[model samples]
Structures are given as structure tokens and as C-alpha cells.
Target: MDRITLKEQLEKYRTPYEEESAFIQDFIQLTEDPLAFNRERLAGHFTASSWIVNPDRTHTLLTLHKKLGRWLQLGGHADGNENLMEVALKEAEEESGLKNLRLVENSIFDLDKHIIPERPHVPEHFHYDVRFMIEADLTDKLVISNESVSLAWFTFDSVVDMIGYNPSILRMLEKTSKSEILL
Candidate 1:
């Protein structure tokens, strides 16, 4: 997908969250280059993440990111991939070591823009993250990659306690709660 296509899709995305709506607008207006993932640009970049849930929708996979030392959803840099959905699924599989993952919806599940603190050679920058919901069997064994300290599934009800409360996670849960996929 090209930038135009992405912008059209994002514009059509419907959500009750005012913040997400504003994010979409900002993303469309901020960068005109297609290679938004280039770290050298220093104008922020696009990232793809999955809010991966078990088949029963009771638990979700999270990775204890080694670099950031935080429990976050599975995802990574776009790496110049214009198709964000494909990026999300690829990251999910690579991070979780799971197969047969299916998208819960074709549309984006969430949107967030956060600042990444500078580390060594990597300078500080913003990440405009696009999130999607993915479902996988709970029985699948997880493999922790070098990028993460560990990987685990947390119950939807206890995720906040397990990983600390995050507004993005809460917003994703709120949005999915109203859908049949989560029900």
C-alpha cells in the first residue's frame, strides 16, 4: 500500500476515541515521505503492533521488551513496509512464535503516538503506532526472541495488574469489548 492508500483507509476508520481520530489526522499531515520508517529521518516513524488474544479472548500475549524493559504488545518497526497489517502479523508471529493467527478485524484496533527516549546511537523520536487485533490458539507454545526478556499471556481482567495500567491497553479493551470478536 502507498501513503495515499494508507491515508484513505485511516480516514475511513471510525472510532469513538477523540485521541485516535486526531492521531489519524496528524499522521496524514505530518509526513509526506513513503519511507516513514527510516530512522535517519528524525521526523518520527510508523510502527505496527498486535493486540494478540487467545482463541477464547480471555488472555493476551505481551513481550517484556529488552531494550525498553517494559511489557508491551508484540510489534516492531515498519521497516519500509507500506502494508501495516502485514507488518503487525509478521511481528506477532516472530515475537510470539505462534501460528494460525487471524486478524480480528480488517480495520485498525488502536492508534498511539509516543516518544521513544534516546538510547546510545539511537536518538529520541516519536513512534506513530498502528495497532491491530490478532487471535491465536492458547495452546501454542511461545518462544522468546532476543528482543525480549520474556513473553507471557495475561488475562484480560488482570493485565493492568500484571503490566501496570496503560491507557492504550484499556482503550483497546474497551473497543474490542463491544465487538463480537471479544464477546
Candidate 2:
């Protein structure tokens, strides 16, 4: 995942949202250093996350983020790994405690850039997050990690209502709803 390759991928990514499109353009322009995944790089860092669904696709997994206290999909810092797909998978498995997870596609499923407020020792910075869809059995045992206060599965409709109508989550639900990817 060199800068050139990532730039190409971002260019090819199609999204109906103007904000996301703008984000892609900005990410391409701002990310020049190969250490784009390191938080110390400061410009911003790449993150990988998963929109995980059960086998039936009727419910999705979300973690109550320990720091933010918001329900979000499982994911974490890239830790310098350029292969974001692998990062998404590893984070999903580690955070969800589900062993049989599989990627819905190798291509990017969603893109977002959000500001992370300053923490104890960490300064305020943006997270250039790349998200992917993953599938897992609902019956699989789920173990919550220290990073999360709790984990749960929620229906797409319910999630939208519960999470207070996030456009990104709705966009993912809309995309997956019509595709065979969820099946």
C-alpha cells in the first residue's frame, strides 16, 4: 500500500456523498509520507474498521467505544500496516472475539475522516478511516475487549434509530441492502 497505490484506489472509489468524495481528494493530497498510519505523523493517520453483519444480515455488530462512549463498528489504528483490509479483519476479530469472520469484499466499502478530540497525552487529530464489510455468524461467541465497554448486535433499522441517524451508517446499510454481499 504505497502512496501511489493508495492514491489510485481513492481515485477509483465511487461514492454518492460529496463529503466522502471530498475526503478522498483531501486524503490523496495530504498523504505523502509512507508512515501515514503512524499517529505521530500528525497530518492524520489511516485507520481500518469493519461493518460486520451476521450470516442472516439482519443484524450488525457494534462496540460501545470505551473512550468515546459511542456505539461504533469494530476497528483500530493501523499501527503502520499499509494493508488496510488486513487491518480491518484483524481489528474485527480482536474486538469482536469472533474467529470465523470473512471479508465481504477486498475493495473499500466506505471512507470517512473525522476529528478525534485531544485525550490525556494525545493531541487533537483527524482519523482517515477506511471501512470494510465483514460477515460472521450471529451465534458465534462474542468476547468484549478492554477497548470496548460492551458489544451487541442490532438490526439495520434499529441501529439507525439507536445511533441517532448517522449518514455513514445509513449509507453502508443502503449499499449492502441491495447487494448479495450481505447474503
Best by lDDT: 2
TM-score of each: 0.92, 0.92
Q: After aligning candidate 2 to the native by TM-score, how far in Å is the CA of 65 from where it should be?
A: 0.2
Residue-by-residue lDDT tens digits, candidate 2, 1-183: 545666778889988878788788777765576778787867589888999997677899999999998889899898988878889999999998999998877688899898889888888888998899999998899999999999999997798777776677777777778675635
Residue 106's lDDT within candidate 2 is 69
Q: Compose the digit string of candidate 1's lDDT tens values, residues 42-144.
A: 7689888999987677888889999999889999888887788899999999988888899988877888988899988888988999899999888888889
What lDDT would candidate 1 get against the real structure? 0.83
lDDT of 2 at 159: 86
Q: List candidate 1 stretches off by more than 4 Å.
A: 181-183
Query: How accurate locally, in lDDT, is each candidate?
Result: 0.83, 0.85
Candidate 2: lDDT over CA atoms? 0.85
